[model samples]
Each structure stands twice: as C-alpha cells, then as structure tokens.
Target chain A: MELWYTEKQTEYFGITAKIKETLVAEKTEFQDLAIIDTVEFGRMLVLDGMVMTTVKDEFVYHEMVAHPALYTHPNPKKVLVVGGGDGGVIREIMKHPEVEKAVLVDIDGKVIEYSKKFLPEIACELDNPRVEVIVNDGYMHIHDHKNEYDVIMVDSTEPVGPAVELFTKGFYQGIYDALKDDGIFVAQTDNPWFKADLIRNVNRDVREIFPVVRVYWANIPTYPSGLWTFTIGSKKYDPLAVDESTIPEINTKYYSPRIHKAAFALPKFVEELCK
Target chain B: MELWYTEKQTEYFGITAKIKETLVAEKTEFQDLAIIDTVEFGRMLVLDGMVMTTVKDEFVYHEMVAHPALYTHPNPKKVLVVGGGDGGVIREIMKHPEVEKAVLVDIDGKVIEYSKKFLPEIACELDNPRVEVIVNDGYMHIHDHKNEYDVIMVDSTEPVGPAVELFTKGFYQGIYDALKDDGIFVAQTDNPWFKADLIRNVNRDVREIFPVVRVYWANIPTYPSGLWTFTIGSKKYDPLAVDESTIPEINTKYYSPRIHKAAFALPKFVEELCK
Candidate 1:
C-alpha cells in the first residue's frame, strides 16, 4: 500500500509527497501532524498539514533567523524564543557561548513533544541544561515578563491564523518591554513578493516601537513566497552598523558576521515600505 | 466561456490559474514559449511553460542586472549587453550620461520583436540612436571584438537550455578578452539554495580569468531559486570598495548607487565559495 502525505501551501494549493512509510503521525489539538521518512527532502516534518522543515534545506531558514540577531548584540546572555516549538531556534542559539539561558514559549505542547520524538537532529539541543521549555501563549508571557531578557525572537506561523496577534502593534510593544534597554528582537516577517503589503504594514507597526528596524531576505523553497523576509528590531545598535572585524568564532552552515551586516540591505520595493 | 489553464509543478501536483486570454504561444527555434494574461501575477510571460517574468516584478531582475556593474565603474563609456533580448538592459543602460554607445546582442530575434510589441514600457529605449541591435550569437561577437567595450553585461537565461555555453570557462575567458584593461563584466549566476553547485562551478571557472571576482545576491520572485546570485569580474578595482558619497542622480524603481555598492557584500556561504 502507498502512503500519501500532503503539504498544503494554501487553501487552494498543495504538494503531495509519496511516503514509503509513516515514521510518526499524531492528531494534535491544532491539526494532524506527522513525520515521514522521504527520499528527496530527507526526513520530512509537517504540522497541521504544513511543512515545518526538511533536512535538506532547514539550515537556510534556521541559521539565517538565529545567527544575525544573536551575533549582533554586544552581549547576548539571556535569550527568549517565542513559538519555535520545533526547537530549531534552540539548536542555533546554543552555538553562542555567551547565551547562559534560553527560554522557549509555545502555545502548543504537542508540537514540541512530537518534534522531540521524530525530528531528533533538529530537536537534539532542547534537552540541554540551559534550555527551559514553557507551554503558554507567547503574547501573555511577553506582557508579564518585564525588562528580563537580552534578546527576544519570534518564530511563529503565518500572520493569518494563530500567529495573527504576533503581528500586532500591542505584541511588539510587549516585546519591546520584555527586552532590556540594549536588547535586540528578530521575527520572521513573511514572503516579500506575494505579501508585500502585509510585510509593509508589519514594518510600519514594528518601526513605531523600536529605534532601529530593518528587514532582510532569504530563500526558503517550501515557503509560499520563495523570497522570504525577516524583520529585526533593536533598542541600541543598528543591525546594518555591525562591526565586521569582530564576528564570533562559531561554525555555521548558512550565516557569518559579514552576512549579518549585509542582510539588512533591502531592495527598492522593501526599502520603500521601511521609509 | 471560462478559459482554464493548469500548470503542473510536480507529478500529480498542479494549480489551475484563470486565464482571460492567451497572448503569445509559439515554438521558437530555441524553446517553446507562451504569454498568458493571468489574475495574480499580472500578464504572466512563460518560456517553455516556466514563468520567466511578470509585469508586476520584472524590475527586480532588470534593475539588479544593470545598475550594480554600471554604477560601480567610475566612468563607463561604451557598454555591451549579451542575451537581454527584452531590451530591459538597454533601457537601464541609457540612464547613464557617460554611456556614449550601447550594443545589444541577443541570439533570439523573435523575443526582441515580441518584447518591443508587448512590453513597451521596458523595451522603449531599444530604439535610441546610441543603441545598436545585433541578432547574432554573443559568443562569436565577443571573440571577434577584443578590448573594444568598457562594460559587458550577460543577461542570459539559466544554464540548462540554450544558455549552457554562457556558464562555461571559455565564455568567461572570451568575455575577459573582449573588455578593456579597466573594464568590468557581470553575469547572473544561478540560485544560491538549489543551484549552489552550479554557482561554485561557475565561480571556479570565472576565477581563472579575472583578478577580482565576487558573487552577490538579489531576491527575484519568478526565478527558480528566488535567492539569485550575480558573479562580477573586474581587472583593477574591487567591487566591494565603492565611493558611497557620490550617489547617482537617476530615477530608478529598484537600484540606487548606494545599493550598487552594497550588493557586493556576500553571505558566508557565498564568500566561502570564493575562497
């Protein structure tokens, strides 16, 4: 018997990858999630019929989102990652020697548990002593924690669904308050091509709270807008004004200190939105 | 009657876009091409059933290919464009006041004529008195003419089909011989994510012929790899070292002199390819 799995891009479009066998599939509160061993993208991980990551190209998204902001801050010790239930962000944050503690807050406990069980390569670092996993709404956690963290990262889903509040100005203000004065925050904005208007609106909203706000681009093949954008907000240092000579001595597959500085250089359409 | 069009992405994977009308569908000597007026991507122009460019986001590809190499040179007098049959390169080249003469060599004559008729906004400058149109193979022309042009731009297609020779070492050496001692040449390399192997191979080939070679990236929506890379070659000057104070006084949709300088800064993966 042929086992079929579907990866939905939208309500209208999806690609079905033929699975030889189902490694794991569990019905979470959110939706049907699964991990299937595949030939092309290596071990394929999916949540709510949406693709989270494939082993072949997960480094592009995970490294790009984690390394730039983490390496930019003068001293990043206590870090908070919101909604990255897959633990990819936690894996990347461990590379920084200065990070003494990392707090991960996600609304869904099942996603985290499932990822730990099936996607061991990505979730391997979650069991480290420095990581603290909290099952709660990220918005409420940020509102309650005041001036507590040196860096905050939001790795939520798309803005249209459960991730809607993450894009609001109120949530950004909460994030601003959660960080120390010199703290930096980074979040996955969206695809710039199909969702330029959405990206523009979010930039306008985030720029209102942070003194230094910039957007960067990366390529993730599974994403709807193949050209993905990430927005960075800082209270002290500008993301573009990074010191090239002082990059951290860490082994990375996708990002370096030079790229951390170059990522903020936006194209004309994106630059117009920031202005 | 409703006209229905379906594009199959993978086996048994397809999305049907509502097409109001089909504009152009013909089998050229090179490839099968079609232009369909669609809903989401505007007038979608497809080459070999693959989406090439749309009216909505063609500026990202055009402005990126033209401005970076042009603005980096202190004074570019004569320019040569290879494989930009759409005339978008010529349109951007005419913006520089120092450019006295421009030559456009495209192997396909039908694409040029069709573009002039359909894409008037982009192809308007092709009729300029300073511009010369040559409908011959670009490889032969560059071989015959050595040290005649100050700037050479290769705006060809991907490496798979008719543009296979453009990515070879011999073509790069021919391009090196065709330029003046201080001249600079730029070509669109493959995508960074899916085409890293091709990019590395081409980078190795170009490194043999040019003293200073750099790989820069841009986010183009329609390309196979949304993370697009451009390979630059120069004889005397480094592409990264630019005079930022001297901003160009030109009205552009996508590129500025400030961006021209910034495009040379590469991510770690790209920089590692150079080494």
Candidate 2:
C-alpha cells in the first residue's frame, strides 16, 4: 500500500507528497498533528492537514522568519515568537549573538513535543538556557505582555481555528503593545495567489499600527502556493535602509544580505495589493 | 463526479487542481496535448502531461520572458520565440514599440489552434501583421537562422519529449549562432528546489557560449513548484547594467523596472548553483 500526504491549500488546488511511513498521527489539544517520513523531503510535520515544516526545506522558512527582523534592529536582546510550536523560529533566533533571552508562546504543546522527537535539528535550540518555552495561548500572551520584547515574530499556521484571532487588527495592536519603543515584528502572511485580500488586509492593518510596514516574499515549496509572504512592522528602523555590507555572514540557506533587500522588491500586482 | 488534474512533478511530489471540465484532450503529431479548464487557474494549456501556461497566471511567465531581454537590448527590432505556441510570449513582445517584427516557431500546431479557440487573450497576437507563426521544429529553426534575431526567447515546457533537445549544450551553441552580436536571450529554466541540477547545468552551458549569463526567478503558482527560474544569456549587453530608469513602464502584472534588477538577485543557494 502507498501512503501519500495531501494538503488541500484551497477548495480548488492542493499539493501531495509520497510518504514512506507515518510515524505519528494523533489529535493534539489544539489540532491534529502528524509526523510523517517522506520520500523526497525527508521528515515532515503536518498540523490540521497543513504542512508545517519539512526537513529538507525548513531552513528557508526558519532563516527568513528570524534573520530579517533580528538584523534590522540595531540591538535585539529580548525576542518573542508566537505559535511556532515546531521550534524552527526559535532555532533561527538563537543565531543572533546579541539575543539574551527568547520567549516562545505556543498554544499547542504537542507540536513542540513531537518536533523535538522527530525534527531534532529544528527543536535543538528550544532546550537552551536562554530560551523560555511557554505552552499557552499566544493571543492572550501578547495581550498580557506589554513593552517587553525588542523583536517579535508570528511564525503561525494559516488563519484558522485557534489562529483566527492572530490575523485580526486587534492582534496587530496587541503585538505593537507587546514590543518596546523601537520594536520590530514580522508575521507570515499567506500567499498572494489565493489570499490576496488577506495580504492586503494584513498590510493595511500593520501599516495603521506601525510607522514602517513592508511585505517581503520567499519561496517555500511545502507551503500553500510555494510563494510565502512576510509582513514586517517596525516602529523606527526600515528593513531596506539596512546596509548590506554591514551584515555578517551566518549559516543560512535562503536569507542573505542581498536577499534582505531583494525580498522587498515585490511584483507589480503584489505591490498593488500591499498598497 | 469529482475530477482532479495532478501533475506529477517528480516521482515523490505533485500538485493537483480541481478541473471544471476538459476542453480538449488529444495527441498532436508531436505530443499529447490537453486544454483543461481548472476551477482555480482558469483555462490551462498542458502538453505531454505538463502545464505550459494558464490563463490566470500566464502574464507572470510571459512578461518575465519577453521584457527583460527586450529591455536589455537598447533597440530590439527582430525577435524570435521558440516553442511558445500559446502566443503569450508573442503578445508580450508586441508590447515593446521598438520591436518591428516577431517570429514564433512551434512544433505542435494543435497548441496554437486550441489556444486560439480557448485562450483567446493569450493567442490574440499570433494573427498580428508583424508576427509570423510557423508550425515547425524550433531546434532546427534556430540551427538554420544564424545572426538573424536581435533577441530570442525560448518559451518551452519542461525538458521532456520535444523539449528534450532544447536544454542541451548544443542547443545553447545553436542559439548563440542564431542571435546578433549584441543579442540577448532568456529561457524558462525549471525551479531550483526540484531541478537545481538542470539550472546549474543550463547556466554552466550557457556561460560557455555567451559573454554574460544570469539566472532570475518568478513566482508561478500553477507550475510544478510555484517557483520558476529564467536563465538569460547575452553576447554584449549585461542585463544587470541596464538602466532601470530608461525601461518604460509597459503594461505588466509581474515584470517591472524594479523586478528586472531584483529578479537577478538570486537567493544564496540558487546563486551558488549558478556559480
């Protein structure tokens, strides 16, 4: 028998991967989580029938989510990540030497548990001394913490179920409140092809709350459209204004000094959507 | 009954689209051709079980192929398109007022016929007075015509069946012989995630024949990985040095003066592949 994993990105379109074996499939407290070994992408983490991360392509998402914000801020010490249970974002956050403490708030602890067992490389940083893993509602966590973090990243799944509130204007307001005076925050907006309105709305909402709001793009094959977008909201610094020559070389697969600015150069339609 | 069309991009992964109806499914003399009306992507042209173009996202691929090389050349008068039977590239080529004539050679006549019937917008320019449509082998056409075109665009499917010869090192040499001394050419190289070797090999092979070779990228959701790459080879002009201010704003959805330069800013891994 052949086992295949399919993500129904939309009603009309989907992507499928051939699975070598199913390691774990269970109903977590928040959503259905699974760890599957695949033929092409190695181990893959699936949440609520959506691909969260895969061993082969996790570097792109992890590097892109953490580095842009960390690099743009002059001195980032306290960082926060919301809804990133797989610990990929946390792994990336540790790459910044200036970071003193990083707090992660994820509603689903099962995701973290399974990731540490299956995706060992991504979850490796979660157990470090400088990291705090909190299993709680990320929405309420942002509501409670005020002016504490220097940088915040929303490494979330699609805006569905528990993540629905994460896409609202109130959430943007909460994230703004949770950051310091010159704080920067980035969120993974959906693809422009099927979720143009979502990207437009997120950009508009983030723009209303932050002085500098920009949308950047990266290609992640396991994602919905493979063209994933990130919306960065900054209080003071501009990402494009950063000097590429000043950036130090780090171990990364996707995000580089050149890509930092190049990612901001959106296609005409995507630029129109952001506007 | 529920119907779905899946393009097995590789042995381990594929993308599936919900089909509204099958407009046409038959074997042309060259290959098996199908025109599928997809619920998500509108009308799609598929040859040899691979997607060539879709009405919804055709502009991204077509615009990226024609505009970059045309704008790089100061005043392109004669342009040649190989294997773009849907006429989408020709339609974009006509947008440049400097172009006096454009010739398109395709091996499969059924693609042109059915695209005219179903994808009328894409096939609109095939009948233009300045355009010549020939149903013949594109490889042989390039071999016969030496130093004839100011710019040549290879608008082809995946390197399979008739397109097999299009990706060879010999074909690059033939394309070099077919272009003027100051000519520029661009071809749709496959994605980096699944076909990195192909991009590397094409870049290496093209660099041997041309003075300057560059690899650029675009987001095309209906394609295999949603990330598509284009390889540009030039004899004299460098695409990177083209003054962005001089490139007039033609009507385009994806390509722009900003994108022309940004597209060449490849990701670190992709840049390494080119090197």
Candidate 3:
C-alpha cells in the first residue's frame, strides 16, 4: 500500500522519498527517465535512478545555475545550456532582458517532452520566442558551435553514463572554445562531502583553461549531500568584482544580491579542495 | 545479507547508510542510544534513531559551534556547554588558550560514557583538567547559574524528547540570565528546509533577549539536512564586527579567519525566515 523511491547516491548511501503515484517511467535513448508524484517533494524527476529535480527545491538549482553567470556578464545577449532537458536552466536564462537568444541542447527529447507535461512551471520559458530547443548531444554541440555563446551553463547530472564525458578536461576545453572573448560559464560540480575528488579535479581542470575560476555553494536538499557546489570559469570578469549594487533586481527565491558574493566564499575545507 | 540504518527525517523522506557493525545498542534512561560503524561515515552516534554525529564529519559541526563564539568575545575565560554529552564542543572550546574552565551539563550520562569509549577523538577533551562534566538537566543548570559564564553553547539535539524545553522562549531567557553582561551564546537551530518555523521562532526569541542576534550555517552531512544552521545571541558584541586578523590562528578543518564572517551571509530564503 506504500511506494517509495530511493536514489542510491553511493555504494553505501542513498535517500528515499514516499511516492504518491508514478506518472511516467520509460527508457530514453540515453538513459532511464521517470516522473513521479511524491509526498514531500511534489512532482519528482528521476533519471537513471537518480533524483534530478523536485518541484519544491528546483528553484534553488535553476536559479543558482543561471543567475550568477548572467549577472556577472555585462551584456549577455546569447546564452547556451548543455544537457538541461528539463528546461529549468533555460527558463532562468530567459529572465534577463538582454538575452536576445537562448539555446538549449539536450540529447534526449523524452526528458523535454515529459517535463513539459509534468513540470510546466520549470519548463515554461522553453517555448519562448527568444529560446531555441535542440535535440542533440551537448558535447558535440559545444565542439560544433565555436565561440558562439556569451554565457554557457552545464546543467548535466552526475558523472555517470552519458554525463561522464561532460566532466572530462576536454569538455572544459570545448566549453572555453564555445564562449566569446568575455564569456563566462558555470557547471554544477556535485557536492563536496562525497564528491570532493570530482570537485578538486574540475577546479584544477577549469583553472588551467580560464583566467578566473571560482567555486560556490548552495543548499539543495534533494542532492546527494544537500550542500551542492558550482564551478565558474571566466575569461576576463571576476564574479567577486561585480558591483552588486548595479545588478538589476530579478524575481528569485534563493539567489539575491548578497548571496551572489556570499556563494563564492567557500568553507575552509572546500577551499582547500579548490586548491 | 546487508545491514543498513535509516534516519526517517520526515514522514516522506529519509537517508540510509550501510553499517559494517553495531558497536553499541542500549536503552538508556532517556532514549535509545546506538554506536554504528558505518561504511561511508565511520563510527556514527545515533540518539533516538537520529544521527547525533559521525567520526568523518564531526569536525564541521563542532568547529562551527565553538569557534565563532570563542573568537567573537574579547576574552572568554569561563564557558558552558548544555546537552553536549558527546564532548565534541568541549574539545573545540579547550583549544582556546583564554578558556580557564569549561562546564558540560547533559541530561544523560550514558552518552558521555559511550562517547568516551567509542568516539574518543571527539570526546578526547572531556577529561581535561579544565572541563567539569556534570550529568544533570541542562534546563535546570541554566536556571541555577546567573551571570557566571562568558560564553554558553546549547548543543542539544533537535527539539524532541528531553530537548523540547531547550528550544522554548523561557530557556533563551534563562541563557540570557546565565551569561555575563558582555556574554555571547549560540545554539544549533536545525535546518531551514524542514524546520523553518523552528529557526524563525528561535531567531525571534533570541532577538528579544539579546542586543544582537545572528544566524550562521555549516555543512553537516550526518544530520537530517547537510545544511545546518546556528543562531548566536550576543549581549554587548556583534559577531560580525570581530576583526578577522585578530582572531588568532587555530587548528581547525572548517572554520577559518575568513569563514568567520562568511558563514553569516545566509541564502535569500534563509535570510527571509530570520527577518
């Protein structure tokens, strides 16, 4: 009489949630995808047995993924999101009035299709006039479109299955080539608790390619450790140098003027990992 | 066969970890106590089926609880810890050369005994000459002591079972009465994801008694949510006003000179709750 969904985050650790009903469960070209209604998190999206996003806490991930890069750029007109089939990142990217064009490249169309039906609020801006949705491999897209995007956001899942390539050094090199001269990019680098090595490697890899690299944090409860980290690689601008007073007010629940810089102040242990 | 321990954080959510062995499981006078050796988190102390601390991540929680208050005060010679039976806070407090004496009051003596046996690294300072361990009700201890301590820390578990009174307004008033005129105190205020009301209520209650009150955060993975909060109430000093250059260097893994000020910069949603 009871159904629960659990994501085995590691070999010995996992998180579980009581489910109300399973709306959809299928195998996409890239991975297994499912949409379920849960008691604590509302509608939940799971891919390859990992909780991707929940209605209650998706704002924290989407807002943090988009706002920091968008606000750091002086005039971000073109934005690109890689592997964000849920369209949550695109929705946040489209918030800036200066964004004349926003492109989202996701290999699996089923994730986009199911999200539109189940998570409309997060995928609302995917159909906007200024947005373009492309069903293609994000890795290849970055290689093909060289120096095209002003702000690039990698909204991929953990480094497993199709996402493995997304965490390599070559992918970061491709991201550097995919951005304009003054471009900035950020990638969700997982949590520091269990993924300390992944974050350290990503920080080192990005540091070699970008002049300014910063690691920031946010509290996303549905994630592996709840303390989620993001790595930003910029060509010229330092996210910390941006005068917060000049940043325009945007509708956000988690990201704010004070939080913009605060996020960059990494904890001592986390800062050591960045080194 | 596999053995796992799950802490049901809420009606719909929980976190599970594989257990290599159960070091101790006993029914104390107050609650159920267990020392589980986990595959991922090393030895973990569980009280009433909730994780109290783990060997791997205990540094983050203990450092944040003690360092901020100790460094903020001009010269804290006398300190008091309430309900910290594990003695992790006392270990961190003893690091301060200025502290001449540290008093620990807990409702249960079994926690202190087991911690001394199992989590020796965390409870190492429990037998220090300066630390006086007393198995007594923390609530009554605060009501008895008046203007006796320079810094007081309430290291109780979530406001449940025996700790329910520790979160009430009268307890905050008692803590205010138990501290010197220029004293400062802090308490673990739970997380914001599930316990927003608790954080809001504690902030309001402390604000009523102290001239200055602030909320800070740290990442503690074994707890319900990795994003843990701490509420600090000061009578004559603002924690934010402390000079980082003056807070002498200490041996720590999480708290740093820069992190002292950064932890106070909360996320937008969390700040909104404190308001």
Off by over 4 Å in 3: none
Q: Give the CA lDDT, 0 to 100, for residue A151 in model 2.
A: 97
Predicted candidate 2 versus true structure: per-residue lDDT over B1-275, tens digit per residue: 99999988889999999999999999888899999999999999989888888999999999999999998999899999999999999999999888999999999898899999999999999999999999999999999999999999999889988899999999989999999989889999999988999999999899899999988999898787778999999999999999999988879999999898998888788888999
Which CAPRI quality tier does the interface of model 3 achieve? medium
lDDT (10s digit) by residue, model 3, range A106-204: 989999999999999989988999999999999999999999999999999889878999999999999999999999999999998899999999999
**By DockQ, who's the top model here?**
2
lDDT of each: 0.79, 0.92, 0.93
Query: What is the per-residue lDDT of model 1 for residues B1-275, given as tens digits with 9 covering 90 to 100?
Result: 76645553334333345567798999998877687776655676666666666677678777888877887788899999998888888988898888999999998888788888887777889999999999989999999999988899998887757788998899999999999999999998977655668888988988888999877777665565456789899887666777766766477766766567666666566667767
Whole-structure CA lDDT of model 1: 0.79
Model 1 is docked with a DockQ of: 0.39
Can you tell me the CAPRI class of model 1? acceptable
Candidates ranked, most accurate by lDDT first = 3, 2, 1
Measured against the native two-chain assembly using Cα atoms, what DockQ does each of the candidate structures obtain, in the order listed?
Answer: 0.39, 0.83, 0.77
Error of 1 at A268 (Å): 1.2
Interface RMSD of each: 3.9, 0.9, 1.1
Tens-place lDDT per residue, model 2, A1-275, is 99888888999999999999999999987888889999989999988899989999999888999999999999999999998988999999999989999999999999999999989988999998999999999989999999999999999989987899999999999999999999999999989999999999999999999999999999888888788999999999999999999998898888888898989999999999999
Native contact fraction, candidates in order = 0.43, 0.81, 0.76
Model 2 scores a C-alpha lDDT of: 0.92
Q: Write the per-residue lDDT of candidate 3 for residues B1-275, one digit (tens) a residue.
A: 89999989988999999999999999999999999999999999999989999998999999999999999999999999999899999999999989999999999999999999999999999999999999999999999999999999999988898999999999999999999999999999999988999999999989888989999998887777678999999999999999899987688888988789889988888999999
